[model samples]
Target: MRTVVFDLDGTLVDTSGDLIAAGNACFRDMGLGDLLDPARDQKTAVRGARAMLRLGLERAGQLDDAVVDAQFQPLLDHYARAISTHTTLYPGAMAAVDALTADGYRVAICTNKPLGLTQQLLTALGIDGRFHAVLGADSTPTPKPHAGHLIATVQAAGGDMARCLLVGDTETDAKTAAAAGVPAVLVTFGPAGADMAALRPAALLDHFDDLPAVVRNLIG
Candidate 1:
């Protein structure tokens, strides 16, 4: 079957707010209140926990792996508790997924987020059933930007790697698609916004409403 793989954070949902809040929660634990700005650091937020933690620690002159490592789990704990508090699905996200499925495409999620947390967030959003598979950072020995990770996800979804495409919002996604020899469609609404075009993906998606057409053009 043809497959459509999506990145979790910035691709399908705006998870930056929750991610930033979690990082701030870690800072508060260290007696540093709100070290990261929600609006300004949104890009870093979607990059994952470590990036947010490192940015906060740097701002506080405490850039140490030990500090970040120690605070990492706490940050994840905080995020897991309030994963969807400020996270929201991008416009037409569900509709697009449905359209693809109706068109006989198998859809899946391949995220850099840990499997447990990814499942938690998707479940919280009440949309976990929408995907055929949800592969996360720890789902395999390797993660995004590695062909094996994406290829493994495709196989898990009962898809042919030759007939797969990736929809995402960052360079990581683009690189992963490239490594897997699949076409990549980068969303313009992500942290990098219109500038995501710099990554030179196979296509640039401005909205989920336009995704089905894009996927057809690329994969069919």
Candidate 2:
């Protein structure tokens, strides 16, 4: 089956709020008083804990490896407690997944998020069963942009790598697809907005409703 690999954060859902909240929690504990802004730091939030922490510390004028190390686990702990509190799938996300599944595509996730947290969030969302496979940053020796991560996800899902497509919201995803020799469709609604087009992915997705046709065109 043709594979559809999705990036979890900005691509499939808006987890930016919770992610920023986690980073802010770390700052709050350090007496830094919530240095990150949800609206302004959404992009960093999607990039993962280190990016969020780095941005917050930079804004607080305390950017350093020691501070990042000191706060990393605390941030993750805070995030884990309320991971889904402010998270929500983008409009038409599940509908498109259902449509793709019905159309015989093997849907799965390949994210930079850690495996345990990814599974926890998926289970909390009650859609853990939707994906044929879910591979996280720690799932393989290397993650997205390294090719092996996405390839491993496809193989685990019993999918055809030659007929695979990646739906993501960042330059990293585009690079991953390029490395894997698959088409990458960058979503326009995420933190990168329409500017994601500058990454020059295989295609630009303005809406999830447009995805099925895009996938069909790319791999079929």
Candidate 3:
């Protein structure tokens, strides 16, 4: 069975704007007052909340692991309240999904984002039903970079792992696919798009408009 699994944050949607805002809220509570700039820190935002908090706290000369842990939930709280305000699906993302599905491929989302938040964001974006299955960090005992996450996601989507492709925008995603012995297709339009080449994914995708051909080449 052919399957395509996607990473949520930077691969499927540009959630950096809202993610940065949530990190900034935590910084403000620390009296740091928006230490991370939205435009300049989109890469860190895509890395996740702890990375954003670390960047801001380090910038303010207040880097501390304990502090980051303490503020994590609050940042998540702020994120949940306005998760979709600035989040957007990458251009032609869903259409690519439709094309793949129509060609008899099953699609799933395997992301490091928490399960609840993944549901929230997908539902808010009104694209939850586009996927056959959605698995997040909490869905498995081991997340990305571990073969289990990809294997479990494939099982959940009712597709065999033998003919699978993983699409993402980060090294972790590439590593996950490698561990699962599947091809990794990294998107090249995110903040660190240029740097993705270093990860040595099976393919580099510049735009979703070209995904169907790319997936056909790689998966078919």
Candidate 4:
């Protein structure tokens, strides 16, 4: 059976609102103006928490490393406190996961989010037990776009590297799969914006239900 590795943020869930709220909280705490414009802020959400903090700090002209770090923890803490408040699975996400699981495909998560937070969000969303394994940014020595995490996930899932597939909504996921010698599918509904089209994934999916069909087409 082929192993399917998923990225948590954009691929599985629409987390931009929560991330923007966290970022805005951080900015507000520092007495800066709001930086949560959905059109502008959603793009940065795909880049991970540090990038989000940097964007907010840069916008506020407070990009000093110390200030960034100081704001980072609090923002993440706020996000954690409100993780499920505004987050939801994208359309068909749960169905797709259930379908994949019932089909005997090993499903796992390979995400850039911190380990504890990843677990918290997954559990809060009620999908934590669906994955055979969950690999977070800190779970490996290096995170996505580095290949180690993907390789480790495949191993944990008892899958053949050549038969494994990575599904995500960002360039980092594409790069990670490429480095690991696995094919990747890029979803169109994430925070990646135009960058998703440029990644040239093995396949592009506009809906989660299209995933199983894409996999069948690829492997068959």
Each model's RMSD to truth, in Å?
0.7, 0.8, 0.8, 1.4
Quantify how close model 1 is to the true structure by its C-alpha RMSD in Å. Answer: 0.7
| C-alpha lDDT score of every prediction, in listed order | 0.93, 0.92, 0.92, 0.85
Give the alpha carbon lDDT tens digit for every residue of 1-220 in model 1.
Answer: 9999999899999999999999998899899999999889989999999999999999999899998898889999999889999999999999999999999999999999999999999989999899999999999898998988899899999999989999999889999999999999999998877678888889999999999999999989
Q: What clash pairs does model 3 have?
A: none
* Candidate 3 segments exceeding 4 Å error: none
Model 3 lDDT, residue 134, Cα: 97
lDDT string for model 4 (110-148, tens) is: 999998999999989888788888988889998889999
State every prediction's TM-score relative to the real structure: 0.98, 0.98, 0.98, 0.95
**TM-score, structure 4 vs. true:** 0.95
Q: Give the Å error, residue 11, model 3.
A: 0.7
With candidate 2 superimposed using the best TM-score fit, by how many Å does residue 212's alpha carbon deviate from the native?
A: 0.5
Error of 2 at 108 (Å): 0.5
**Model 4 residue 19 lDDT score:** 88
Candidate 1 has an lDDT of 0.93
